[model samples]
Target chain A: MELFMPLFIAVVLVFGLIKKVPIFDAFTDGARDGIKTMLSIAPTLVGLIVAVDMLKASGATDMLCGFISPAAKQLGFPEELVPMILLRPVSGGGSTALLTNIYKTCGPDSFAGICASILAGSTETTFYAIAVYYGSVGIKKVRHTLLAALSADFTAAVMAVVCAKLLIKI
Target chain B: MMNLIFAAMIIIAVVCACVTGKGSELAQGVIDGAAESIQLLITMSGMMLLWSGIMEIARRGGFTAIIGRLLSPVLRRLFKKLPKDSKALCCISMNVSANLLGLGNAATPFGISAMKELKKLSPHSDKASDEMVLFVLINTASIQIMPTMVGTLRQIYGSREPFAILPGVWISSVCALAVGLTIAKLFCKNGGS
Candidate 1:
């Protein structure tokens, strides 16, 4: 897996050389464009990240998790994973913190810990993706992207627990 | 829509903080969050530049085109709105392949480039087209073949088999992608864009 990247780079560069492409000039041009892309999305990143951080710091995430625990339990979702699932689609840092917290409280091989790992692995930060991708192009009206992404995240969260229970012995 | 969501998040956080007596932490979060984003950008910039450079070479050398052609059978069904030979298709294919390889640092550059091409196809410069929304949906669904970060974290936490949850991860990822695509297609069919 580690060698894939180096090998891919070598192949691309070698291919570029064979094709008579000015690799250095092409690289610099793309890097310049990359800088521009970064600058354009910087404001969006700041706003979204700050909002997510504030939500976490305000203790609302935990409170919401508590509020949703009963319904989540009824739906067969593990109560211990409510917070991680809630934060998964919004904040990567927040969810990772919750995952480690689970590891600390529950052994890493335990159901909750394994479920947390699977959930974290299978879900992307939807809000961050939407913010950066649309923000880069200055797209304001995202329409149904949020709804679809969140639906997928919810599915992934459910499937994580289901798969963990079916696959893991403990 | 985004404006409202952003405003609502800030408003809810402030109100919740005031009610919960977490005003200080909230203030610190706001300050630190902004700084942390910049820190993240700095860390990511190097990879972003390298991947962008590599992608540029690949595109110029016709490698991306080759990939686009190979993936076109699958990509064509997903991005029905795009022309067969659209530049966006090539970039999107590269982005998706990078993601599948778990090269997240490499994926972002290709994704951003794909978004640029999609934007060119958008009738309104500021509104997201259906294809753009679908592309974002695919990315946010977590399609990596291996969850390397999770495995590493599991190993750090002293798991006997760090990658033992691979089956679970794969099942969940496939489910997420399937559901996300179905929902996106349904929404697009209703002319939600």
Candidate 2:
């Protein structure tokens, strides 16, 4: 991973050089630009983090688990998957925490099942994505976007489960 | 409350923007703080540029085109109402491309672009058309080939190959996307309101 990081950076450096722009200047500017953007997003991310932390701490996740686990089993998803599917629409970081919990309980090479579960967690929160992205862009035409995004998330969650169960052997 | 979000953001930005009442020499520390973040900024920019390069190579080298062509058969049936060269098609392609590389950050712009394109074909602006619904379905459940983020994490932790989970990743993504599309089609016909 450390090797990949530098290699990835090298690829960018080479590409930037080929494009004939100043390297150090661009790098500094790019860094400065990143800091500015991070500052812009710092509040939202912090608020989201706090909200999710509170939600999880308050047992909202457990409530969701109770609500969704039976349905998930009916849908052919495992009980463990319920948390990920439930948590993803609510919080990516929270889902990450849940995934760590799963890994600790089940182990990583619990193979295809674990793999599939994690994939679902890595997916975007369709509803939240629409809310944040559209909200950022000042969009009012949200009725369709919301439906569209939610539909996508809902479908992806199902597919992630099925593929994990049947397609990959380990 | 909706527009108030922007107002709140502006206020926050302004508050963060203002800082100094201290003496001039002491104030240098305030301005100096922004400089430290430049290193991380450079790291991020470099990461993004690499991913863009991967996407460029993929698109420019016909990887995306081949993938598109491979997908065209099913996409044709699934999205029959949309034109062959529609902007929605382009956006879907872009979204899929970004997703494939595990660049969710990069995919957002493409997803929004596709939505805008889909909106043009929408009837009432309040309702998603059949095509819009299907487009969202497939794009949402879009199969992932390489799981970059996961792979990177595994690699960091010293997994043997790091990407050994590729087969499982591909299978789950394909199955998920397929079932999602089928359900969307069914819902579009009988259940949409």
Candidate 3:
């Protein structure tokens, strides 16, 4: 499947060019715009990373871990997952830092660490995704979409824990 | 200074954890893991740029419009509150298509574009409407066919079978898409009425 990605891209480009089309110009324009978009997101990404480090520095991460430890145990998740979940509303990198903390503690091959991996991949950062996407377009009505996204996140988290306990064991 | 402080704390954690044999593996794992995560981000970013370029090309080439036309009927059924002719629909379709193909980093811009269109049609100034909410829900629950993030993790972990997750992914995503849309529709209808 991975092997097909390059092939697929080649096909798209080839198809575009063969159609008597302007491939080079279109691609350059897209790249130019992509750089603009990347610039917009870069600062936010840095700030998010820095703030996450600060939270860890302030011992906030430990407090979060302490609080979520019981739930983690009860839910059969790694205690480090608390910070992971808490950071979901804020930043992906923030949660990644927490997840690293988990894999470090639980051992990367453990169910706990794997579960954190699942959670990271499975759930969308609902509020953050909405805020960034909507803010880009100046949209306001879709605030209600958070409910649905969060619902899915809630389901995914529960399923992730349950599946980790069941499937990872298998 | 803060990054320096965090680094020190992590190093301390690694030593303490390793010495105590208390989750030291994870702390040490973090030390070993940093370069990989950074590398993964760089790789993912490249993919992102490539995808964004592809999307831009599609839009410029009118391929996106073609896709929108092909998907209009199906999208209309899924998104009833949103008008077929609206810019929101175009954005929504691009966003959904990007996610479905496991191109989320590329999807962000389209999603933003969609919302801009949706906001115009929306009567409210501060709040999202029913259609916007539904769009967000569907995008969030986006039945990802490729699960790029997971694939990346598997690759980083040296999984010889990274694509094996496809079955589980298809299963979970289909379930989430169906149920999420159903519940959102039900909730909106119930709530709005």
lDDT of 1 by residue, B89-191 (tens): 8799988876775656668999999999999888898888889988999889888765655765566667778777877898899899889888888878455
TM-score per candidate, chains pooled:
0.66, 0.58, 0.66
Q: Can you list the residue pairs that collide in candidate 2? A: A159-B176, A163-B172
Reference interface contacts recovered per candidate? 0.81, 0.08, 0.26
lDDT of 2 by residue, B1-193 (tens): 3245334433433333343222342234223323423432343344444444454433333455566667666666666777888778777776766666554555678877877777777666555566665655544543555554455434333445555555556665565555555555565644532
lDDT of 3 by residue, A136-159 (tens): 656655644666676676666666
lDDT of candidate 1 over A1-170, digit per residue (tens): 34545677898899999999999999998778677766776676677777767777898867876988899879877777986787688777557556755775686788888889999999998988998899999999988888889889989888998988887764
lDDT of 3 at B182: 66
What is the DockQ (computed on Cα atoms) for candidate 3? Answer: 0.26
Regions more than 4 Å wrong, model 2: A1-80, A104-106, A111-118, A129-170, B1-62, B157-161, B189-193
- Cα RMSDs of all predictions? 6.9, 10.3, 6.2
Docking class of 3: acceptable
- Rank the candidate models, highest lDDT first: 1, 3, 2
Q: Give the TM-score (vs. native) of candidate 1.
A: 0.66
Candidate 2 vs. true structure, TM-score = 0.58
Clash pairs, candidate 1, are: none
Strongest candidate by TM-score: 1
Comparing 1 with 3 on TM-score, the higher-scoring candidate is 1
Please report, as a residue range, the 10-residue window in candidate 3 chain A with the lowest summed lDDT.
Answer: A48-57
